[model samples]
Target: MTGSVTLVEVGPRDGLQACKHPIATAARIGLIERLRKAGVKRMEVGSFVSPKHVPRMADTGEVMDAVGSRAEPGDMVLIANARGLEQVIAHGARTIAVFTAASDAFAQKNIGCTIAASLERFAPLVETARAAGVAVRGYISTITDCPYSGEVAPEAVVPVARSLMEMGCGEISLGETLGRATPCRIAAVIEAVAAHVPIEALAAHFHDTYGMGVANVWEAVRLGVRTVDAAVGGLGGCPFAPGATGNVASEDIVYLLHGQGIETGIDLDGLLDAAAYCGDTMGIAPVSRVFKARRG
Candidate 1:
């Protein structure tokens, strides 16, 4: 609908964070490296969450070391708090994303903190990062539905988004973490958030659980959102979101956008190859409908 959008690849972070089995550190780094070679300028390389709670991301430090030393411009991590920020500082991470859910219950369950507490903790991290010449990003989870809290109101998402910006996050990513958001619901949340947060500073993170991720992406684009978060080979799921699917596939987003004459600056063939490779390394098949249909 407008200029090019920044598609932030989240395969290495959200994609791997929810997996039950831990992928080899080398394989995980391989995924990030391949994505970089495929011309993905921005990525959520990994997270600094507790390894015991999420064994899949246990190799956080190692993965950071691997991706950090080789990171090109614009690569980053989904940090949890000030400690996480500190951990990635040595990796030379300039862009860090702090996440919170729109539903209070989900926030408590996910991070053991109330919504306000989570934001309060992140405020200092954001200040410290910005003071030291780093950029901060924010993620608002459960924009549509929450497993623990059921349906989430569009109004509920706005204040959190606003709060995150007040905390100094450069952008706010609205996540349909449970994958229950339809195009209409997505538009509703966007409309609500627009009243309080500028559309230009907003992004969408949709999952394909009900085959609506792409459609939701179209809705987001129509609403003037310039950033969209995706993952390769559809490789992520949320532990708290029932029937949650992996993220909207990067290859699919790239294909649809490029076909529509939008410039995403990604190499389609290279993206496909990287998706296939990551799938292979993770011992899974590519779940993107576009990826499978194209091969046929």
Candidate 2:
């Protein structure tokens, strides 16, 4: 708990992707710059996917160009297939992330494929990324509860995480996409996945829909997860998962970790400024407790 944790800010990508109104590309760039200025070394800048499917991320190339050297070593873009990988590589992305899921139902809904099929599709992509000297990270969603399929088993996540690890992913993030899982379930899934994948190579991504985001994160940290995915202002939810809410706010995570005498290498006040900028751009108030409390 005392050691430094790496918080991968997902605000620019995951946070703004599901917005009802189109977020201007300039606003996205501003958010990313503000986050970097706040000492967020690792972040999900954007994704390389079809504009038709995810129009918000269509300007990823432009964002990358504008960010230029400001993008830190661990900054990453999500890639869904070979095409996405090619585009991100062309954009000079140093790191890329691929995603699958523990639930076949959610996979079919989100990516139009089964769990095994998705892995097969990513095989060549991962190999190609490795050869190109780009770090690869993998994500497994619906670690405990699936919107399409209810009550996923912890064991269901093991093989998916292990497969990503065996395929050369430096890190695998386990996602509680539904935001309904409590600390007990979070511990269960992490423990199960850690058995097959190295504990050091796992990250936690949680939603705050049910107000369990911070508590779930505390559980993951207790279980030895050092990397966490969060968004500024708690922006973003799973478009495919009905009723799902935004991710755990970055400000809240920094407060929790710092309060516990843990290091996150993030400045809370700077992060709040970034969050406020994000909220203003989107015309919505930040829902993070710490942000609201501090502003008051």
Which candidate gets the maximum lDDT versus the true structure?
Answer: 2
The pairs that clash in candidate 2 are none
Total clashing pairs for each candidate: 0, 0
- Model 2 root-mean-square deviation: 1.1
lDDT tens digits, residue span 18-128, model 2: 877888889988988899889999999999987888899999999998988334577799999889988888888889999899999999999999999999999899999
Candidate 2, residue 250: Cα displacement in angstroms equals: 0.5
Tell me the tens digit of each residue's lDDT in model 1 across 1-296: 54697899998889878887668999988888888888899998888777777778767778767776335558777778767778878777778888899999999988889899999989888999999777888999989898887899999998899999887888999999977778999999999998888889998899999899988998898888888999988888887667898999998998888877778999977888887886678886778877797752
Best by TM-score: 2
Instruction: Give me the runs in candidate 2 sitting further than 4 Å from their true place.
Output: 69-71
After best superposition, candidate 1 residue 150: deviation in angstroms?
1.7
Q: What is the lDDT, from 0 to 100, of the residue 3 in candidate 2? A: 95
